[model samples]
Target: MKPQSMLFTIYGEYVRHYGGEIWVGSLTRLMGEFGLSEQAVRAAISRMLKQGWLVSRKVGNRGYYAMSPRGQKRLDEAAARIYRQDSQVWNGTWCMVSYNIPEERRQLRDQLRKELSWMGFGMLSTSTWISPNDLADRVREITVTYEITDYVEIFNCQHLGWSHPGDLVEKCWNIDEMNQAYQEFIEIYRPQYEDILQKIQNGQEIPDNYCFVEKTKLVHEYRKFLFIDPDFPKELLPDVWLAADADQLFQDYYTLLNPCANRFFDSVYEPCPLVEANEVNS
Candidate 1:
């Protein structure tokens, strides 16, 4: 895994639970389990800091890092989607965003598209995106963040269309491809989950560090769905969906590994002291 991506997984799965911050040394040590060099970890952290995803604080000579408000909001949203048990009930309304950003701000336009896609909006056209989810607040935030409010328009309306809603879904997204990916996930992890369950049933003692590694890897792999899975509402999904099955397996396997994993993590985790907000550096 790339150092930065792995760091995000670690932060989302581990560090966020323990006070939402970590010492740089502790970060490097935890990353060491994945064979990442300290230099690589530091460089990734630096890049994240520059990207406004991290804020730093200094206590004496030691430095600590935590997610900024933007980062925290993003991770919170991701966690909600990741652990959601049921598909949202669609109100038969689609949230559509249409934009005509200037060519001079091409970078902003690209970033907006990426953000929209990440939020489960599918591109209906080169300049228009749609999602079944109600995302007015999220869209507003993105437009403000990119300073493109004037170029963007948001609407919540029923699809009184010439084409069926399902056809629009197909046109905007590759549901078959996403379903196939979920099937692959189930095939790979089901056996591992069964093996571990059997081991537990036989009263076999698993190592704490081993559980930690397994849990982290499991979460890392499962969290990829956050990017690829738009998590469409149940009414919009196919009759047979493997994403739900995959989600259940992930939850079970994660629960099975959590205690030992947390124990191992606590052994290596070093907590940082809280400082006043103004005293911290961004």
Candidate 2:
């Protein structure tokens, strides 16, 4: 999710839970808890209310808001999209950089710090800053409110304490869910992998060129349009559930993708070569 969307999604979830326009003071408190400002919180809320992402009701000179059905659906869709299999193992050093926090929100900050600490965070150089496990998603929820997206980069330092740079986005899902999803995902990939392995064993190789066609255009098109990043692998594939039923999955992924794949084949078919990164001792 984008930073703004992240901010609203958090607030929207809160409103949905509370079931009313939260008091302005409460909203401000939440903003502070997340190391955000009153102005930023108000603007995000106003934007959400305006976009019909939330519906607001004025009660005693304050507006209480909650997400519409559309907003709920939006969040559900995002959950499905955002929660994917873990790409690799955990490195255990993701940091949260908090800035411009207010003095009065000290209690909230302390509480947040404690929660993160309980979640296995360590004290970094900052007086209040905390370093959690090496996944950026939790830190990103706060960063999202602050309008920081894609601020990720390969970072490693002695003061910061790291062995090598890492990618956090690929490890964002809840660990348990990730483990389950990954097992399922791997199981789904096994047959395809076996088939590919057999082809290689039989001295057959993937063709360098095609007859200007692909198997699954809908999967490809829907992915590119609905998702901004759309960073898919070279070979078009279906989801775990779909791929679980291999033959059916293959057919569906291909049949639904013909016309669209043909249309874009001229432009977007580059084969990706996967490389393994060497382990570094931190």
- Give the alpha-carbon lDDT of every model: 0.89, 0.42
Winner by lDDT: 1
Between which residue pairs do clashes occur in model 2?
21-64, 21-65, 215-254, 216-257, 217-257, 218-257
Off by over 4 Å in 1: 274-282
The window of 10 residues in a row where model 1 has the poorest summed lDDT is 273-282
lDDT of 2 at 165: 26
User: What TM-score, over all chains together, does every model reach?
Assistant: 0.95, 0.29
lDDT of 2 by residue, 1-282 (tens): 232454544443334434423455655554454456788877887887676677665543444555667677555544443333333443443455544445665655565554444333434434434333342565555445444333322222223433222222223212334335435544654565466447657987444222122222112222222222221221212233232243234344444333443444333322222224642211
Model 1, 1-282: lDDT tens digits are: 888888888888888998889999988988888889999999999999999999998775688889889988888888888888676567899999999999999999999998998898988999999999899889998899888999999999889878788788989998888899899999999999999999999999999988988898998888888877788887788777799899999999999999999999999998976566556453
Task: Estimate candidate 2's alpha-carbon lDDT, on a 0 to 1 scale.
Answer: 0.42
